[model samples]
Target: MSGGRHSWITFVSKVIPSLSLSLFGQVCGISGCFNILVGCGVPMRSINSFALIGMALSTFFTTLRSFSTATLQLKASKAFFLGFTNSIVSAPMVFFDSTTVGRIFTHAYIYIYVYITHLHTPTHTHIYMYIYTHTHICIHIYIYMYMYVCVYIYIYIYIYMYTYIYIYICMYVYY
Candidate 1:
């Protein structure tokens, strides 16, 4: 009887919490990614773009956050190298695709919120400082790149529209 009770207690304390955490992460990842992708013109049909983007963003942010925090706490040099590598690798994806940039920002915001709520120690005080600096730098870079892309696309579309309008006006004048 005691053994059975102990097993139940273990399950409740360990397994249930793990399962709940996994479920929460999954829900946040899926929904957050879906909303961002949908807002960015990715269709909800034929491809699970929502889940894929969501999971990618979630995993990317979570791993990055965890790595950054751990490195900061440990005062590791590898963190800087990792950050540089990440920026280089992710720059193209973000620059070419506005949707990916949106997803990344959204995921980062959500991850920060979740991280803050789960905080538990005074020793973790500097964690936010690290997060803030890293996030600030990343946000600036992404924003500049995204804006550049948007402006280029907008210019292209505007030129096309202007050309069409000019042609139409010329045809009307000729007639």
Candidate 2:
């Protein structure tokens, strides 16, 4: 189908590049850190700036890949569903007259679900497995964010308690 072909074109144009960039970023991040750790002249003196840059790039590219795949999946599903619906709607009255409403509805639903589910299954599996396996690569970022929030909360609570104690002491001494 033209829609399927178009979806593949979109996937190749968007997803493949995103996946490659994400892998490149990951390599960049790892190599930068390794270079710094091994005390390479340039990296040791430069404060390993590449590590941070690579991390940012990796995060961005990974997120892009995820979003692009999701978008592609939705677009393909919509295209297929719409095409099927259009054909059903534009069919001759004779075609519908012989088909019961329940049968038509059942066939429509089954076809949409079955076709979409079965389409490019191996490709979907590879994409999903990649996503699942690599998901943990971003855990450090999440951990850092969680630690930041925790620190903020701790500071707020400490300040609040200190202020409360200060007020209590002032009232006690002044009274």
Candidate 3:
């Protein structure tokens, strides 16, 4: 392919579908869980079971997406280094004669350093931060769900207690 255009096209093909699928899966799973938690229905056991399956599927798709993206990034970085090495090897003898080996290495080192700092470092950090925030959000959601269920349980208990007391008083007075 011309100028490695085909490789990029292939990378995109491998990446985009997984990315979209993962996003869709996550949305469906999260929404399903949310609905199961909030909606009125007595048969939550069945609905929650489905939501759990959806969430597991979502996690699987997300892992697949991450693996694809990582593989693509690895291929890209390898190509970059291969091209750099080829360029150095093909350079004219005169250029090497004029430039010291140290200077050549220094130049390559600087380029690679800058490239890694500008590209790889930020990407990894972004991924880490994104994962952190996502986990944090999930924890918060679980906490809220716990609190919501607890409140309802307490309310039901209180209602039952009061009803029992009222019935007992009525029976005692009538007797």
> What's the lDDT of the predicted structure labeled candidate 1?
0.50
Provide the lowest-lDDT 10-residue window in model 1.
142-151
Please, what are the lDDT tens digits per residue for candidate 2 over residues 1-175? 3768899999999999988966764554454343233333333333245644543444444344434444565455457646766887888889978896557756555554444345465325544333333333432232233334334434443564455446434533543
Model-by-model lDDT, in order?
0.50, 0.49, 0.50
For residues 77-137, could you state the per-residue lDDT of candidate 3 as single tens digits? 4576567668878888898888875576556655644454455443245333333333334
Ordered by TM-score, highest first, the candidates read 3, 2, 1
Number of clashing pairs, model 3? 0
Model 2 ranges with Cα > 4 A deviation: 1-48, 111-123, 126-175
Error of 1 at 138 (Å): 21
- True lDDT of residue 49, candidate 1: 48
Top candidate, metric TM-score: 3
Query: If candidate 2 were superposed on the true structure by all CA atoms, what would the RMSD be?
Result: 16.9
Quickly count the clashes in candidate 2. 0
Model 1: how far residue 132 lies from native, Å:
17
Return the lDDT, model 3, position 91: 88
Per-residue error for 122 in candidate 3, Å, reads 9.2
